[model samples]
Target chain A: MAQARQEDNATDAPPEALRAEGIVKRFGALTALSGVDLHLRKGEVLGLIGDNGAGKSTLIKTITGFHRPDEGQMYVDGEPVSLRSVAQARALGIETVFQDLALISELSVYHNMFLNSELTLKPFPLLDNRKMKERTKQYIDDMGVNIPSIDTQVGRLSGGQRQAIAVARSVYSNAKILLLDEPLAAMGAKEGAMILDLVQKLKNEGQVSIILIAHNYSHVFEVCDRVNLLQHGRISYDKPTSESSVEELTELVVAEYRKARTTS
Target chain B: MAKQAVGGDVGASESARSSPGLGSRVAELLLRQREASIFFVAIALAVYFQSSNSAFLSSGNIRSLSEFTYATAIISGGLVMLLICGEIDLSVGQAYGFAPIAMYLADQTLVLPVAVIVGLLATAVIGLINGVATVYLRVPSFIATLGMFFFLGGVNVILTDGFPKTAPSGSFLTEILGGADWSGIAWCLLIVLLMHILLNRTRWGLHTFATGGNPVGASEAGVKTAKIKVGNFMLCSALGGFAGVLDALRIGSIDPLAGGPNIMFFAVSAAVIGGTALAGGTGTIIGAFLGTVVLSIMQNGFSLQGVSAYTFNVILGIAILTAMTLNVYVGSLRRSGRV
Candidate 1:
């Protein structure tokens, strides 16, 4: 596996799996991402903290190829690239867990896991359902997630379970960079802890880099090796977990909030 | 370790508790219909008609109704996919009648099978246009298809000189296309069955549903919405054309004016009655089949009972309106998490 990744790493992100530098986006008069620069290192969980309109979503969307920036560039590794669409972003091993989780409610867990990347067999080119079910089960167990059945529809699962399933999908797809938008916001503490542990597990694997967007500073602090504060469509502060305390980050967030309020 | 064991036990029991019994499963298949209520109504109508008049369920009668249903339902299966994905194809009726008419014209002047293939291909091209206009050009499906309907309807009249040309009787290929056997069930039902499996079991089926459920989500998740919609448009139109040819063959004549405006409504009504929604995102192939069955049965029932043909339309309108109302209410309950 390591050797295979090394070969593929010719296109692999260097040190940082994903990077967005000088991103600028405008919607008529309002700017969504203004010269924001951020990068995620391999195997580290980087938290992005911001308010509702803090350009966090826009930045992530830009990085994931949902919205192209008006001016600026994005890099997957050290090599610069232009993401015209989400498919291009996915091809570069970037996967996103949207706030809505992008789950097809009526489909079973196994079916949802392979919605876009379906497992196919020869002759008829039909879906390989049995393999998908088995693979889904293995993934859940490998991640240490407890679910009753792989056949259960995502709609029926708890919020935490759904979040875990989404994260697991990215992991199973061999994603090198994961962008999770508020994955633990709706869950209780037990669920939150489970997700945190999963984050740690990914970090230990040393094959994945993550940019987790959250309003919960404590949760961010618990998991992230580095933290980036987004404000007014730009990165206002970037620091390692060891170098900066939560109190300093909180002050930075508040100061940015106040700045935006005054300017508006 | 003890705590973990207890948790595991609880999880197992939870699965057991929620697991439905065989009876309930059967009930779900029968009564708790996802959208197949329309088909049930068709069956009920058939039963009612048959009970009142022995001839109503006779092989001949069954065969005739099925042939009619086959052509209508095939076009409908494609429309269901379109409607599910938040698009409409108003040109299907005109396209339906015209494709076969083109084939007949070709058959009389040109070769035999070539005519049929040409008709199907022409319809597919129209479908391609509909798909491209709607998906790429960003024209709303209703306006685009409606415009196509006008254009095609005019084109058909011009080509036929206002009268449809007829193919020779007992042509081997036409006979098979319109063939009905021992029980009067048209061979077209086989096509419908094949379509059912394609729409329900394949990756294309999954993508179709996903596109309908949430196109934006589906697209972000890697589904090519444009390609799916366009491909669906061609499939729907092609089926319409195919149905038109089969209908002409079954009846032993081609009528440019026959199966006109009323055909699309029949297809849409069957689709809605089966459980597909105007809002898109929720429908099943079984539901569509059931809806077609219901309409057919109702028509059979009223006719066998010697009811006025005028009253049949009124009765159908009422039935459809009632079913759709119930469908909407049930859908709301599901959405609100009350179901």
Candidate 2:
């Protein structure tokens, strides 16, 4: 938060890791996101806070290529990019950990981590079981968290453990930008702290630009360098965490929620 | 706790072991009611007839039953995969008709292997067209395959002039496809066995489940779900085409009208009975095989035991309905947190 305030004072331009310019999205008669601009720098955690229906999901979807924005452009590492599909976004080193977790419950930890992207031995097409299992174990060890086993089915995993796996999966993809949609929404205080620690760990590693989206301003304020508040499909306030309090962000979100409710 | 103790003795290592076991149990219950019920009923009647007539298990009757299983299982295998991906191919019956007729025509009019290749290519093309239309063109597989059905059926009628046409008698190719071994299993059963492995053990097999489980989720995981669906549709039709060729050889004649009807019903029946969901996800190739065997055994037993042939239809209908109901109920339980 201190560093974010310093950066804000030094420059008002977009950060280098990720950027969006005049992002606009519409669904039939409704505008989901309108003329929104945001950016993230390497190793910086950006908290995206918005009321329900304030286009948080739409913005994430558009960035992740699940839904393309009707107007505006997104850039990764200062290069123009068009995300036609989720696969394209992933290939572009932009990994999104959806709130649903999107994990296959029946598969083992390693299998779910890799999913369709299983490492296969060419010429025979047999999966490199040893490599995948070993890599999965290494990731578990690297994360330094409590996981039962690499062979554990995701369904049997606790919610916190499942979230850990989702994080591990995105990190394993070697993503330059990690978009986490409410990673701690359904988690307990302990789990939320563990995730915050993990986010901090990743930040310390300085590997990627992480975007944390949550309605919980407390958690957001704990992890983010900069916070952006959305109201009526536009960025209402964008400032460093040092300059904003949890109460201010909560008031903004609640006000926007009331306004949207009355308008609808 | 006692149940847990008993479960341990019963080989329960998984705490959620109950879920998988319950899934298979539900599958078994549905399996018993659908394709297997008729067989069970037929077995009961067969025992009665054997006790009374003493000629119910005759080799002729056994051979006839086995033959029915051969034809039904191969087609059902492909259909089950299609069902798992939430698609259908109404044109398979016609594909069945066309493949053999085309093969016969190719051999007699063109050449041997070349004609066979041509017939297969034609079938593959039909599959390709269906895949493209369904995946890229974004049409529901039901409507697209239904359109293919009418088109292929019409083509069959026009090509064969509305009657059965005999292929040149005594071709070695025909013998291999139509002829049976001492075990009474056709050579095609080997192909079916290979398909079983391909569906159960391979990566594509898992991909089929993934594509069906949630197409959006699968795509997000980079599964190329559309391509997978297209490939599955093509694979189903290819198998149908192959089955058609074998049917021609077995009958020693090709009927333009041979395959245009009842294939969707039979294949879907076999699939549903085999524990494949019409809603997609969770299925087995062996179940499909067993399903066909059960259905055929019932029909054969009815004919052998001198039961009314009309009764077989009623029994088949009841069996299918029972399987479907069981499947629906168990599926609902799974969704409702009972399983």
Candidate 1 recovers a fraction of native contacts equal to 0.34
- Model 2 segments more than 4 A misplaced: A1-15, A22-34, A66-74, A78-85, A104-110, A127-163, A185-201, A254-264, B1-61, B180-186, B332-339
Q: Name the TM-score of chain A in model 1.
A: 0.91
Tens digits of per-residue lDDT for model 1, A184-257: 89789998898889888988787889998988988888888778888778888888776778899878867777
* Per-residue lDDT of candidate 2, residues A1-264 (tens digit): 556656674787545888899999999999999898998877789999887888999999888899988999898888999789887888888999888787766456887787777787778676676788999999988987789888766766788898999898999889889999999998999988988999988988889889999878888889888899877788889998878998887776677668869999
Worst 10 residues of 2 chain A by lDDT: A1-10
Candidate 1 residue spans exceeding 4 A from truth: A1-14, A24-32, A69-73, A186-191, A258-264, B1-27, B31-43, B179-186, B332-339
RMSD to true structure for each model, in Å? 5.1, 5.5
**Interface DockQ per candidate:** 0.42, 0.29
**lDDT, candidate 2, B166-276, per-residue tens:** 765476765776643322255446856777777654577667777776676666777777877888878888788877777666677788888676865777787787778
TM-scores of all candidate predictions against the true structure = 0.88, 0.82
DockQ of 2: 0.29
